[model samples]
Target chain A: MLSQLVFGAELAYGTMLYYLVLFLVLVLLIKVFAWKPINKMLNERTQQIVSDIDSAKQKHQEADSLAKQRQDELNKSHDEASTIITNAKQAGQKQQEQIVSDAQSDAQTIKDNAHKSIEQERQDVLANTKNDVANLSIEIASKIIQKELKANDQKALIDSYIEGLGKQNESR
Target chain B: MNDKISTFFLGGLTFNIGNMVAATVAAAIVLVIVVWLSRNLQVRPTSKKQAVLESIIDFSNTTTRGSMSDSDAASFKLYGFVLFVLIFVSNQLGLMLQVDVNGVTYVKSPTADPMFTMTLALFTIALSHYAGVKKLGFGGYFKNTYLEPFVFWFPLALFEEFSNFLTLGLRLFGVIYAGEILLKLVGGLAFSNGIVTIIGLAPIELIWQAFSIFLGAIQAYVFVTLTSVYINGKISAE
Candidate 1:
């Protein structure tokens, strides 16, 4: 058999032709059944992965921005709240000072009015005492003079002088 | 060994029906398996079968791209894939079982014959030349392939082309043919003395069969690798 292969074996042209045809058919079949669809699928999967990664990155950026915005709002509100508290505290302090000042002025006015009324009362009391003294002297002098005129007539005279004195004091 | 090939004459050409049948069977097996594995394929593969299929395709792609640019590899990858599958299957077919009726072998490895391997080698070389011409014009192709480095190297380059074709085809034929012959010789040991020979030589036969399987796979790889290299040689610039 080896000798025949080396020396006596004739070339098989028909087998070659058959192989050519078979190989071509096989290529065509594989192209339709395997290569086309598989290659397409592979390319599609790659594209899908790329797009998914891109979308994920975009979403991550969006989340970061949103978080930053929320933090900014939170910070602003915190500042606003502190300002309001400070403003309220300042207004309360001002009101407290105004109340204290008003009370001080009211006390001063009360003290001045009390002093004026006391002075007026003291002056009235002095004038009344002077009138009482004056009346008492006049009565004493008239009584002494009547007593020396006559013992019997002196009583009548003394009574008349005292009456006059009383009248005079009433008219003045 | 008696050389008996079943021949039929069609027109002026003689065909080896046995080899044609065997080759066709091998091709059919490859086609069915490939088509089936390719069916219901998802973008995200889930099945072990799909993984196997993808690995096969990846193996072919990687092998081709090793010798050529990705752009060039794209066109020839299917060719490389088909060549590898067909050759691999054909090499293993005879090892599984060889059918002999009378003195003619009805079933064997199609690649063991000189005619089929030579045909494959011829196609590969011719396709390379065609691609070379397509990539570079005819004048450029000629100068690059034969007259490169020095004009004095033309004869040697020409001789190299012939030798490349001869070696590529004959190498496959020689290895497979010799392997099959050794297998037969080992198998003959079992039948020589009935039971004792069968028992003792069974291990030897088994070992040789395993080795032959390994050889077939290697030869398939070598063939595809060389095919890509040849194509790359022609298409790429110095």
Candidate 2:
């Protein structure tokens, strides 16, 4: 019974063992070779996504700084224009008072002269304020852009500015 | 039914009824899985079902692409999935069904048989040769194979061929055959003793059987994973 049992078991095993080895070898070979390339592509794609995100972030920072500079320039020009308008108003008031005190010229003529000169001064201030704003805005913009010229850094600033413009356009 | 399931000879090797039925069942199960997964696949992969399927495919795809070139790896993705399902199902059959024919019990896992593994290995090896030949002409393929060693050992070329066949067939056969035999031996020993026999008939047998089923599933996965590795090695340079 023992001999028969052993023989039967061996026969069953011998028949199957050959196939198992073959299958293992084939599987091992394919896994090592064919599968590697697919994995490589996945890794490459992941890296590309990361790089894209980094570039986008840099662009945001650059735009943020450019916007800050533009705001400061606008505020400076507004202050200067207000100072000029206040000084002109004070000079016009003084001339009107002097003509009234002298009593040589008609009161209506003095008032008309004061009004005409004030109007002229207002026109001059408008022209100068327009020119000042233009000049000041250009200088601020250039300074903001030139602050950092590293490839990635510069790209960020430009991207930030474009995004700001885009937002403004969307609002309008 | 007999006519439809006729046995065919391949190089004098006999393929019996069990082999035919098992292979058919394995193929059918695989096809079902593919169709089911195909119908449910989503563009964004949000649902749990879609995510589960995509993850397996994605993991395998990433591994394969890393090993081979892009175009070549893309072509081989589905084959890897098919391999996983087929081997798992085939091994599970042994635990699920045990047949007794003429007082001799046959607990056959398709993978436990050397014939099936050998056939699969031979198929892959032949495919590699075909790929090599296609990439490099027939003359080049033979030249590369034989010319690997110092130019004088031409007679050893046949031995090299035989060794490849032997190693591929034996490795899987040894592992699975040993495992199945070990399980049978343990079960047989338990059955022969009165004390063991009493316990075997109780809930322990069911628990043992279930555990065996799990083992079968795991072994099958291992077998298929190894097969893919071998196939990849043969077809690509790296």
Candidate 3:
């Protein structure tokens, strides 16, 4: 009876309806066993991804702070460098001005010294000319007196007077 | 051709070569695709094809892990691959090929065959028992079965086994077979009637065909998914 019931077909012959039961059993078994693993794996994967994302976000936050601090330090260094450069430039400019002033002072002093030397030389020349003129007058008078004395003593006396006149002319 | 299909096996089983050929071709195509995709899998997804394959793998893995404990989930991968290949091939067989002998042409979808689907379902059910026995020794497996109802209802346990197998096989085979028959009937009518059939029945046939394809794929997925669930239940049980 069970065989008849199992083998019975509503349609034509060769219709194996018993296989339907076998198929259902297979599907039920799969539903209980295979599906569990797949679902378990999915849940685990989702959890893993969630945790990974959280950790990633945390790491990113940490890195962001470090970057900001480094940027600040860099900015500070840049500012310090600019200040140092500005100071150096100012000092250099001051030194250049001082050097220029010193050069001008030295030039002015040299010019004044040259003027004094030229004036001193002019005075010395004038004094030497006056001495030369006096010397020449004295020498010419003595020579004329000596020559007249050789000719005659009286002539020599007149010659002295003439010499004196010549001396006076030379002096003039 | 009909006589060829109805030829006697060792028992009363009728073997259809056309159906078997179509199934074999489909299976071959499935194997080739698996080899092609898996051979080229990369650490990092590249092309759309690779990405699609990787995503499928990833989805399967996640599903396996979610459905079973970590230990059982590892084994679930093989089962998933088998189920996927079997169903995909069976579903695509009729769609891909048409075999004609004399006047009557036949396109037998492998999933439409009760024998093929029944064998698959039986295999799954048997595997479930193996998993149960392996996880909970032979004694424990029997103990769980008895615990379900009154201890005297041991026979019901055997009945339950048959019931599961029946539903799994019939659910798939019935849907596929009926859908195939409907399509054939409608297609024959349309061809014979031409423009008049298109005006009257074409839309209905198209809708049914589309829905049947959807049902076919869904049934395969549901069957495998339930199988995995059962396996996980058996193996993971304390």
| Clashing residue pair totals per candidate (backbone < 3 A) | 0, 60, 55
A1-172: candidate 1 lDDT, tens digit per residue: 6645572477878878988888889888988998887888789889999999999999999999999999999999999999999999999999999899888888878887788787777777678657766766666676575456668787787688678767866876
Q: Candidate 2, residues A1-172: lDDT per residue as tens digits?
A: 6523532221233323434443454445444443343345446657877888999999999999989999999999999999999999998898888877766566677888999999999988787767766765786588676685678877886677667657745764
In angstroms, the error of model 3 at A28 is 25
lDDT of 3 by residue, B124-220 (tens): 7888889889888988787765455567777887787788888887788788777777777877788786789867887988788678768867876
Tens digits of per-residue lDDT, candidate 2, B146-206, equal: 5555566566965866666666655655565666666676676667878867586646556
lDDT of 3 at A26: 38
Task: For residues A1-172, write the lDDT of model 3, one tens digit per residue.
Answer: 5533542221212223333333344334444444444345557767878999999999999999999999999999999999999999999999999999999999999989999898888888778767866776777688666665445766766677678768766885
Error of 1 at A42 (Å): 0.7
lDDT of 1: 0.86
What TM-score would candidate 3 get against the native?
0.57
Best-matching candidate per TM-score: 1
Per-residue error (Å), model 3, residue A104: 33
Scoring each candidate complex against the real one, what DockQ results? 0.61, 0.05, 0.05
